[model samples]
Each structure stands twice: as structure tokens, then as C-alpha cells.
Target: MPIRMHDTLRRKKVDFSTIEAGKVSMYVCGVTVYDRCHLGHARCYLSFDLIHRWLEQSGFDVHYVQNFTDIDDKIIHRANELDGDWKKLVDENIETYYEDMDALNILRADDYPRCTDYVDDMIRITADLIEKGNAYVADDGVYFSIESAPEKYGMLTGQILENVRSGAGGRVDDTGKSKRDHKDFALWKAAKPGEPTWDSPWGAGRPGWHIECTAMSMDYFGAQFDIHGGGHDLRFPHHEAEIFQGECHTGCSPVVHHWLHNGFVNLDGEKMSKSLGNFWTINEILKKVDAMVLRFALINAHYRSPIDMNDALLNDAERNYNRVLECYVTSLKGCLAENNVPLPVADFASTNPLSKSLALLEKMGEGFAKAMDDDFNSREAVAKVLGAVREIMKMHNSDMDAVDSNAFSHYAIDWLEETAGAVLGVLPTREMALAEPEEDPRKLEIADEVDALLLARTQARSDKDWAKADEIRDALHQMGVVVTDTAEGPTWDLA
Candidate 1:
């Protein structure tokens, strides 16, 4: 089936076709870079990352661009509070942003255009908007004249102009500022004392929050691009302003072919808020949970659905992720043991557990693709992954002796790794996840102790000492080890 995605502008899912054949130019609004990224940021970026991964997997050459709002009110205020240079603060946070994102395994964008680096381009676009009579220079700064392009102005938000209030119901504030209309937002802000300022035709000032994205996106993807995305909160004045300024300058009808917005991250039934002290930064969360587990938790929900962050949700995610990982590891071990042995091709077509398992694996792959193709529904895709892993595990345990050398088993292993590991990025490669590192003496001693306890527990069970076995299991659980008994044997993993 052809790929379809929900376009916020159209308010419906539509067939997705790139502007250029077999190629996609996508621009997602990135971080403000004033502070650490939070769960909301993770949700937005990870959603796009999944989209990027699937597009590439589907044979589309995707040029993904994400921009940084390096210079902003928050950055300036924080810099002043720290008694440090704004650039230094931004630079430090930018590095931390990379560190956090890298930990999450999000693919790096093709281009990361910082706002400060494109002041000249922003000035040119602002000047062009003024010349086109779509914007006007005020005593304070340049503002996009909403009334100038009335026909195109609220198309993205579907708001009727006359009925629209001056402040757009607190979505934007026009108070105490020079503007032809209250709905008109800033294109440039005249620099205040001690604020970072750049030389511009509008006097020494910086680009407004909305103008930076338009300027930077146009610089990379031209006046028109395949898709533009950000958090759902940006669907209002921020994105709407981009549409107004971009079209007014380029004389185009739609600035982008599609507009995608991921839903917000909610905490305790409310929007995650820094002021409420309910928000958790990616770094803060990573310190407590593994990065892969957090990534799975973030992607387990549909990108358009608000994910509620809480201990229970994360715990469930951790357990589900461990199941997937253990299955993959088991398959990996089997493939290594049966190296270079190929199953009879005829057996794969026969009606047996091996062939049935292959069929299920194929069906799972189809489901994964179908879910992803339909608006990049990662939540459904992940379900399909778990289903495939479950079926693969059953076949591994039940039919290993019958089809130990079957090529289908190897094929299944490779398919699982690619779909779950490469496409979803939830599973790391064996080299990365299982490679032995230089061990600390204390950790080695702990491992030895755990191994000895596991052996004793196995013997106790064999001797029918259920009480002793349960006691050892409880002790191991206290030490952060989880034990599961399978038909083959008992297996243990970290909690």
C-alpha cells in the first residue's frame, strides 16, 4: 500500500507523495537550546525519527532537517541569571542535547540549522515580507501584518479572521506593542539592553521565534518542501505565522506539502509542565532507566496520542522491552550455534511448526509495514514486533531440534533484527549490547555470586526443594536479577 500520513492542515490522512520522486525533504522544528530536553521533546523528535527510518526503509531518500532556536528569550534570561554569555550557554546546551539524543539512538538530521547562524537570511526574508506589504516595521520591531494577507492567514489553524480576537485568546499577546493588528505577531524584535543583538535593517535586533524556522527551512529545503513538523502546540500562531510569511515571500499557496504535529507528553493527566515540577528531562530519566527502555516507552504510543509519563507506564515498558530483547538474544545464539547450516527449502513450504513460524514472521513484517505506512503508527508497529518475537520464541523452543539447520530460522532472525533493531531502533546490535567490557573487580565478584546462587537454585529445584529455590529466587530478585523458567532451562536477566 502507498504511504499515507495525517496532515494537520487538511485535518485528514492523505496519500503521502514527495515533491521530488523517491525523495523527501522534511523539516521538523527542533529545540530552543536554552535548557535540557524533556520527555515532550523526546516524543516529538522520536516520532520524526521513526518517520525518517521508515521512509528510508521504504526506499525514499529522505533529507531530514531540524533547526535549533539557539537565540531565544529563555536563553538570554538564563544566561543573565548565570552571569554568563548567552552564546556560551547555548553552546553548552547544544552539546548536552546531542548527548541526550544520541543516547536515545535518534538518527541525526541531515542538517541542523541554528537560528543564530541564519540571521542574515532571516533579515532578507523579513525585508522581503515588508516589501511585499505583508509586514510592517514598528517602533519596537517588525511584525507580520495578519490583515495584509487575510485570505492565507488562518488557513493552517482554520480560524475565521473577523471572529479572531486581538490576542487570539491568549495564544498570542499584542499588548503594549506597535502593530496594525493585535493578531499580527513579531517577525523581528528590537534588541533590548544587554540582549544579544545582530545588525539588521530593522536596527540591532534578533529574529522572532516563528521567523527563525521559516528562514532556516527555506535556506535548506527552498521555498517549498515535502513536510513541516513540530509539537502540536506549534499549530497555532507559530506555524500559522510561518505559513503566512513563507507564502507571502515566495508567492506560493502552501509553504509545505504536509504539516505533521506529534501530540504533547502528559504527566499525571495534565500536560508536562516545568512550572508544575512534573516534567522530567531526558537526562534525569536516563539516569534512572536504560535509554532503550525509555525510547521504547516513548514510541509505544501513537505519535499523535499524548503519552502519560508515570512509574507504572515505564515499568510496563521495561518488562515488554526485556521480552523483545531476550527473544532476539536467544535467536542470535541459535544462529551462531547452527552457523553455515541451511534448512531444506522444501521444509519451509511444508505444513509444520517451522513453516508456520515463518508464515507468522512474514505476517508480522507485513503488519509492521502496514502500521508504519499508515501515518507512521509506531505503537502498532511495536505490537507487531512483540507478536513476532513471541511466535519466534515459541518456534525456537518447540522446533529447534526438528529445524536446527533450517535457513528459515536464520532468515527469521535476520528479519527480526532488521525490523526491530534497525527500523524501530529499539534493539541494539549484539556487538553493542552484548560485547564484554573491561570488568570491575567488584562487579565480577557480584556476577560470580549471582551465578553461584543461580546454580544452587537450579539444583534445589531439581531436588524438589521448592522452599529453598523460592528463597534463592527472592534473594536474586532483591539483587536486581529476574529469573524465568522455560522448557529448555531457567534463564535470568537483570531487573
Candidate 2:
């Protein structure tokens, strides 16, 4: 119940104590702009959004930054395949990324530093690394010497220096790449024919994948910050390389105070990827279900736990999402409809509520904070929120008025709205979902009108006035209702 989180460093849970008290700086590895955003991407961003929300809700002033890899090998390759402009491809995909995330209610990062925008800073850092003897120029470009950094190579990734495998297709020429060890990665790559390039310390070239984060994060949040996060897949080469570069430039060992990574998203128990051909783009999935349900499905399991997304699981998550939203709306309706409403208060409880539903809200709120503090266990924190929602529904069904007065119903609703809505960037209103497909109330109203008209038409038919009966039928049809005659008489419905 106390504010604690599992520190991936120590490999166990510990009480969260920030490097600097009362302030938090967090950065997340953002998208590479070559392709459409997918559900797996949503899982990463949404998970971080919840962590950012909980941190801010817990009274920490969080300056969150996420970067975009706007210029990369994939972006260039994709552009060439389509005979498209490289910058245009990056620009279009970046815009699409924002559109997809906005649809899912993801909080835009305080700073979205694109790799292209920070090329100058990256050059500066590369120059610094070269001057400091941490990087060397290869025939193709500049490479970071793994042997020059302060910590042991592969300290963060736990990869053995000798046995590491480099990624395929883009290996620097072995001649000029004076890596003390073979595992040393690139800092900059010399521009190839038909590739996007910028002028850098080692001639006209682009920043390497890992160097981009190092330069951008240090430029924004200082050489060292409170937290750094990305996918579990990135912990090895990407993040480990980031740490090495940051330390080489800043003369600091741990440029990040804490490291966090969310687990993989599996599609039907297999990793979802382009190769698998089972990747569900966010837009593609949005067409099938609401964004909140997709978000709920991602967070239901622990952040570090793998999830195999299936139709039944998604339906279950949708039901849960609807139930939570319904309870929140119903509670607000009751609170607004109550007497002697409690004034908004600022006191926060650090213990779990055991006695009543209102106390449960306080308890769950505390649990949310504690869970987040413990290393940003957003999965556990969200459980507290869902639990509070469940308790509210139970009380609402049993005794609405008594529950309103006896509990901090007003305050709890406000808290949920603020923390869940503003902070966590989840649902701000029940209206997020479009009109229900089942019998709409307006349709029902029209149906009633149609029935009345049909009754009048039946009477007119019974009176032997075919002209009057036809006139009534035409009038009802004009009102967007269709009437059909049956053996029993007439039945009508809204169109």
C-alpha cells in the first residue's frame, strides 16, 4: 500500500525516492516515423501516459518528453520504395502518429523533439565525444568506442561485449571503425547516395539511432534526469547506448536515475510485427472498437506482462470500459442531484479505504500513488482506479442518496475526473463513445409517433376511406418511419 515500485536496477521493489524531492523528469522513447502507428505502439504510449498522469496527480511537477525518430534507415528505405520525398514521408507519418494518439486520448508530451530537429545538437555531442576520445571516425561515419565510456560496456543491457550481434544491413566498414571491441555501435553515419543527410563533425551524415536520444534528452532535461523509459526490446542496444553516450559527454555514470520498460504486445500469443503480418494499426483497430477499450485492454495486465490480444479479451475489456464510464456518469448525475453537497477539499489520504465506498476511493487513490511511486507500476495503480469505480457502482445500485451523503461522493467524482481525466489522459466524459447502435431514444420517440400514425391509418382503413389511410401512411413515411401491414394489422418502426 505504501508508495513503492519494483526497481529494474535492484531487481526488486523499493520505496520511490526521487533524485530531487518534489520534482520528476521523465522521458519516453517515441516512435520512428516510417510506418503507421499500431496497437503495440499504443500500449507503450498509453502506459507512459498513465505513469505521467499518476506522477502529476501525486503532486510531482513532471516535465515529460517524448522524441520522434523522423530520419532513419527505415524512413529513407520506405520513401525510396514509394518514390516519395524523405522529409515528406517523415512529415506525413509524424502527423498520422499524432492523429492516432490523439484519437486514443494520449497526452501529448511536453516536448516532442524530432531527431531531424536536433541534428545540430547531435553533431555537437558527436564532436564532444570525438574530442574526449570516446568516438572515432570510420570511413562510413563516426562510431562510439565502447571502451571509452565510464562504465563497463553493456552494463545496462547485460550483454557480453564479445558475443553481441550487430543489427543487419547497416554495418560500418570494418577498416575505419576502430572499435576497441566489435560490439561498439555507431554515433553518426556518413550520408549514402539517396539518403537524407546533415552536415556533422565527421562530414555530411545523419545521427545514429541511439545518439539522437542522448543529445535531445540532455538538451531538454539536463545531462541526467529522474526517469527514462522505453520498450523492453530497447533496453539492450538503444538505451544502453544512450547511457554510454550521455556519460561520455557529461562525465556522469548514470545519466538516468531510473529505467522503465513496458512488456511486449502479442497478437494471439505471438509477437505482433510486420513479419508476422498480424500487426493491427491503431486506425485499423479503432474502426472495430473504441479507443478506450483498446487502452483498457493494454493496461488490464501488469505493465511488464505480455498480452495476447484476442476478440473475446477485447470484448471483455470493452464491457469493463463501458461499466466504468457508466458508473462515473451515474455517480456524477447523483452527486449533482444531491442535497448539502460537500465542498471540494484538498486533503489526501495515504491509506486504503476499508469501511465504506467513499473510503475506498481515498484508499484506492492512495494505492494509485503508492503503486506509481514504487517504480511507476501503472498496472497496479489502474487497478486501484477500477476498484474504486466498482465500489461506486455497487453503492449506486444499492442506495444512491445515502451513499452520496455518507461518502465523499462529490470529492471522489472530482478526483476521478481530475486524475483519470486530466492526468492519466483517459476518458474525460462518457460522450467519447459515439451513439449506441441499439434502439436510440430519438428513434424510439419516432417509433411512438409512427405507431400513433399507424393506429390512425388503421382506423381510416377500417372506416373504408382508402384515400385517408394512404395519406396517413405517406405522412408517417415522410417522418422517417416505415409502416408495414401484417395479417394482425400494422406495425411501424423508425427508419
Candidate 3:
């Protein structure tokens, strides 16, 4: 199946088609760079990262661009509150952003255009808007005239232009003092006292919040691009303004072919916010849980679905993650056994248990791909992965005497580690996922006891004493040990 995604503009799922064949130009709206990234940020970026990985896997060469609003009211205010320079504050947070995202294993964008770096480009676009009569220069700044393009002004948000007003959050100070229309958003802001200023035709002032994205995206991907995405909060004024300014300046009909927005990260049934005191920063969460566990938790749900952040969610993710890891480690150990035999290819057509198991493992990759292709539905794709693991475990435990365990292990391990791991961006390496926990002397003593029980169980089974074998297995279970009897030996793990 071809890739199908929900476009926020159209508000429906549509088949995705890039402007350029076999290539995708994607621009995801980035952070403001004034504070540490939180779980909401992780949700947004990881959703796009999933898309990026899937695109690459689907044979599309994706050129992704994400920008940073290094200069903003938030940054300036945060700097004042911290008694630090605005640039220094942005720099610190940008570095921390990288560290946090890298920890989550989000793929880096091809270009990260800072707002301050593209002041010249912003000024040029602002000037062009004025020359085209799409924007007007006010006493304080340049504002994009919403009246200039009435039909396309509110197309993105599906709001009537007449009822739209400025100052709807993330809007520039469009106080009705000098603007023509209340809906007219700021393209450029005039210089303020003691604030970062850039040289422009209007005066030494900085670019507006929405204009920076238009400038940077156009600079990187030209007038039109394949996909523009951000959090659902941006669907309104921030992205709406991008569509207005981009099309008006470039004289293009559609600025971006598809608009993707990931849903919010809710905390305990409420939206996460700093003021509400429900916000959990990525760094803070990482200190408690494994990074891959967090990534798995975030991706376990559909990207467009709101994920509830809580201890329960993390715990569930850790449990599921351990199940996958256990299967992978078991497969690796079985494959590395010296006396294991390979299943014959000629026997594949026969009704042999090993051949049936191998056939199931081979089809898992296609199942994974099919799930991803349907709107990048990661939740379903992850289900397929876990389903494959369950099948592998059933074969290992129930069909061990009839199947070639080594052959099944080789195929399952490669598919889980290479194919599924590549797009999921988790469980890539064995050491990371399956590393042994630090040995405790007390636990070591328990391990010796568990081994002795397993040895007795094996001997009982070999001596045809079924009742004794069952008794030993019951003792191991009571001691919190889960033992699976195989043809080679009994594999034990802590319950």
C-alpha cells in the first residue's frame, strides 16, 4: 500500500504524493529554544521521526528541515528572569535540546535554521510582501494584510476571516493601536528598548514568530514543499499564518501539499502545562526510565492520538519492552549454539514444524511494513512486532522437539533487530536491550538454587519420572523462576 496520511488542512486521510518523484521535502516546526524540552516536545518530534524513518524505508529520499525560534518574547523574558543574555539562554537550551532528542533517538533534521541566522531572508520576504500589497508597514511593524487574500486567509484553520482576531496565542503584539485589521498578524516588529535588533527596511527590529518559519522554510525548500508539520497547537495561528504568508509572498496556491499535526501529550486527563504544574521534562523522565522505554511508550499509541503521561503508562511500556528483549536474547543464544542444526530448504514445502515456523517469521516483515504504510500507524506496527515475538516463544516452548530451533532463531533475530528495529528506532543493538543486570551476591546465591532445581527437573524428565519433573517445576515456579523445557535444556528466567 502507498503511504496515506491525515492532512490537517483537508481534515481527512489522503494518499501522499510528493512534488518531486521519489523525494520528500518536509519542514517540521521546531521549538522556541527558551526552556528544556518536555514530553510534549518528545511526542511531536518522535512522531515526525517515525515518519522520516518510514519514508526512508519506503525508498523516498527525504530532505527534512526543522527550525528554532531563537529570538522570541519567551526567550527574551526567560533571559531577563534568569539574569542571562538572550542569545546565551537560547544557546544553552538549543544544546540541551540536542542532548534530549539524541537520548530519545530522534533522527536529526537535514537543516536546523535558527531565526536569528535568517534575519536577512525574513526582511527580504517582509519587503516582498509590502511590494506585492499583501502586507502593509505600520508605525510599529509590518503586518500581513489578511484582507489581501480573503479566500485563502483562513483555509488552514477553517475559520471565517471576519470573525478571526489577533492575539490568539503565539500572535505578535497586534494591539489595535496601529494595525489596519485585527486579524492582520505581524510580519516584522519594530525595535524595542534593550532587545535584540536586526537591520530592516522598517527599522532595526526583529522578525515576528510566524514570519520566521516562512522565511526559513522557503529558504531551505523553496516556495513549495511536500509536508509541513507540528504539534496540533500550531494548527491554528502559527501554521495558519505560515500558509497565508507563504502563498501570498510566493504567489503559490498551496504552500505545502500535506499538513501533519500530532496530538497533545496529556497528563492525568489534563493537557500538560508549566502553569498547571503537570509538565514533565524529557531530562527529568530519562533520569528515572530507560530512554528506549520512553520512546516505546510514546510510539505505542497512534501519533494522532493523545498519550496520557503517567507511571502506569511507563510501567506498561517497560513490561512490553522486557517481553521483546527476552525473546530477542533467547533467539540470539539459540542461534549461537555450536551443535544447532540448520533447517533444510528442500523441506520447506513439507508440513514440518520448523518450516512452518520459518515461514511465519519470514512474513513478519511484510506485516510490519503494511502497518506502517497505512498512515504510519505505529501502534498497529508495534502490535505486529509483539505478535511475532509471541509466535516465536510458542514455537520455542511447545514445538521444540519437532522444529530446528537454531534456524527459526536466525530468521527471527535478524528480522527483529534489523528490519523492525530500523523503523522503530529501538532495540537496535543487543547490548543496549539485552545486557545482563549487575550481579548481586544475594541474587547470585538464589541463582545457584534455581540451577540446582532445574538440573533435578531435567534428570527427572530424562528418567521418565513425570511426577518428579512436575514437582521440581512447581518448586521453581514458587521460587519466582519461570522455566521452559526445551529439547536442549531448560531455559530459566526470573518471574
Candidate 4:
């Protein structure tokens, strides 16, 4: 089945097709590079990261471009707030953006075009809009006339010109009285004192927020592209404005094939924002929890559904992630011991427990694909993977011990790579996860103590002394060792 997505323009889940066959050209609105990224940034990028992964996994060539608004009002204000150079601030913050996103395991975009570098392109587009009578100059700067592209105005957000109120175009003083309509937005702003300025046809000024995206995206991807995405809050004035500007500039009605906007990341029950003083930076939260835990919590819901982020959610995600990791580790270890990977389905022709469990694992992988195919339903897809791990544990403990463990081990790793590692992107590959972690001196010192306790637990179990086994387990916990007894035996990790 063809992939489907909820297009913000059509406001419906439609069958997705690229402008070019077997290739996907995507453009996601990037950060303003004014500060360290927060949870909201993670949500937006991860949502599209999953889409990028699935498209490539489905055999489509993906050329993804994300723009950086490096010269925005926010960047200038932030630079002034810190009494620092705007260029230095933008460079430092761009580095911080990569740090935060790389920690969360998001795949980097194919290109990151900064607005400052694209001033020439912005000038060209604004000049063309003026020549075509789609824009007019004012005392302040050039503004795009909404009347020129009336049909494309409400194509995304459905807010027509008649319903547009004063100051709805993202300016403070209503475009300084030269704007044709209250809804007319600035394509270029005339230079202001003490701010960065670029030479443009309109004047020596800067490009507007909305036009930066239009200019960079059109310059990178051409007249039209597939899969334009951003945060849901960008739906209105930001994305809505991009529709008309790109279409009017390029003479293409639907400049972007599909518009996808991921929902917000709410703090507890309220909206998370720096203005509200309730948001947490990505680095800040990662300090308290693992990056994978935060990644899973952020994506545990539908991409278009608002997710409440809190400590409890992170804790739950940690537990769920551990459950899968533990199973994968156990299975991979078995494969290593057997010195072989799982063979083809034809090799598992018997109706024995091993073959049956492998069949179930294959079905669960299909279930994961089914969930993801229906509009990238990652929440349901994660549940399917968890179910596969649970089934693996169930089969290992009861009936699979007598059969060859090769198929189970290799199939388990394959399923996880396809589902968790590929689509969800929440975990690393099986080899990486099973690789010996960097040896800490503290853990090394306690290895002997852990072994002694495990030996005691083993002896207790052999003697049917449940009480002593429980006591040894408690002692191991006090030593900062978390031990779980699998069908293969006991596995312990430093807590």
C-alpha cells in the first residue's frame, strides 16, 4: 500500500505521491538559532525524522532540506540581550542545535541553508514579486499584496482576507500604514538602525520571516517539492503565508505537495514555551534522563497528537525502553554463543516451538509496518515491537529451550532493526546495544561482589531457598547492580 499522511493544506489524510517517482524532496522549517533547543524542537524534528526514515526504508530516495533563520529579530534581540555579537551568537547556537539533535539520534538533514547566505535569493524572489505586481514597496519595505494571490491565501489555514484582523500579519504597528491590506505581510523589511542589513531591490533591508522559508526552499528544491513540514503553531501566518509567496513567485498553484504539521509538546497539561517559563531545554532534560528515554517519550503518541511531557512520562519511557533492550541483548548473546544467525524461513519448516515463535516474530514485524503505513502511526508501531519482545521472552522461558536458538536470536535482532531501529529510531543496532559499555572503575570494582552475590542466588535457587535468593537480590540492588534472571541465566547491569 502507498504511504498516507495528513496534509495541513487539504486538512485530510491523503495518499502521498512525490512530484517525481521514487524520489522525495522534503523541506522542514528549522530553528531561528537564537538559543539552545528545547523539548518542542525535539518533537518537530523527530516527527519528520521518522518520516524521513520510513520513506528511505520504503525504497524512495529522500533529499531533505532544513533551513536556519540565522538572522531573525529573535537572534538580534538575543544577541543584544547577552551583549554579544549576533554572528558569534548564531554560530554558537547553531552548534548547540546540532549537539542537542545529535544526542537525540535524529538524522541530520541533507542540507541546512542559513537565511544570511540566501539573501541574494530572497532579493531575487522579492524583485520578481514586485515586477509581477504581486508586491509593492512602502516606506518601511516591500510587502506581498494579498489581493494578487487571493485564492492561495487561505489554502492552508482557511483564514481568508475578510476575516483577517489588524496586526494579524506578524508586525507590531500594522505594517507602518503602506501595506495594501491589513492581511498584507512583509516580504522584505527596510533596514533598521543597528540591525543587520542586506542589499535588496526594495532597499537595504532584511527578508521577512515567511519569505525566508519560501526563498530558501524554492532555491533548494525548485518550483515545487514534496512534504513541507513544521510545528503545528506554524500553520497559520507562517505556513499559510508561504503558500501564496511560493505559488505567486513560481506560478505554481500547489508549490508544496504535502503539508505536515506535528502537534505541540505540552508541559504537564499546559503549553510548553519559553515565554511561559515552563519549558525545559533538551540538554537540561537529557542531563536527568537518557536521550533514548526522552526520544521515546516524545514520540509515544501520534505525531499530530499533543503529548504531555513530564518526569513521569520519561520514567515510563525508560522502563519500556529497558524492557526491549533486555530482550534484544539476551537474544543477541544467544546468537553469538551459537556462532550463527537465523536461517531462511524454509529452514524453520517444522511446527516446533522455535519455528512457531519465529513465525510470530515475522508477523509482528508486519504489524509494525502496517501501523506505520497508516499515516506514520508510531505509537501503535512501538506497541507492536514491545509485543514481539514479550513473545520472545514467553517462548524462551517455556518451550523454545529444547530447540535451536539461532533462529530466535537472529530473527529478534532483524525485527528490532526493521521496527525499532528503522521506523521508531529509538534504539541503536543490536551489536551496538550489546557492545560492552565503557568500563567504569566503580563498576569494575564491584564486579567481583556482583559475581559472589549471583553465585549465592544460584546456590539458593538450586537448594530451593527462595528467602536467601530474595535476600541476595536485595543486596545486589544496594550495591547499585540491577539483576534480571532470563531463561538463558541472570544478566546484571550497574544501576
lDDT of 4 by residue, 1-495 (tens): 989899888889999899999999999999999999999999999999999999999999999999888997888888999976999999999999999999999999999999888888888888899999999999999988988878777777888667767664555543446776768888888888888898876668888889999988988789999989999999888998898788888999789999999999999899997788998999888889999988888778899999998878888999999998888787777674553544536224666666666677777888888888889999998899889989887865664542366656766777777778877887777568879878888888988888888998999998999999999999889888999999888989888
Across residues 414-443, which tens digit of lDDT does each residue of candidate 1 receive?
Answer: 887778888889888777656655665655
lDDT of 3 by residue, 242-275 (tens): 9888998998979899999999999988989889
User: Comparing candidate 1 with candidate 2, which one achieves the higher TM-score?
Assistant: 1
Spell out the clash pairs found in candidate 2: 3-370, 4-374, 5-374, 5-375, 352-363, 353-363
Q: Evaluated with TM-score, which candidate comes out highest?
A: 1
lDDT scores of the candidates, listed in order: 0.86, 0.77, 0.86, 0.86
Question: Lowest-lDDT window of 10 residues in candidate 1?
Answer: 167-176
Tell me the spans in candidate 1 whose CA falls farther than 4 Å from its real position.
Answer: 167-176, 337-350, 436-495
**TM-score for all models, in order of appearance:** 0.90, 0.80, 0.86, 0.88
For candidate 4, the 10 contiguous residues with the lowest summed lDDT are 339-348
| Model 4 misplacement above 4 A | 167-177, 337-351, 399-403, 438-495
- Give Cα distance to truth, residue 309, candidate 4, Å: 0.7
Q: Model 3, stretches more than 4 Å misplaced? A: 165-176, 337-350, 398-403, 439-495
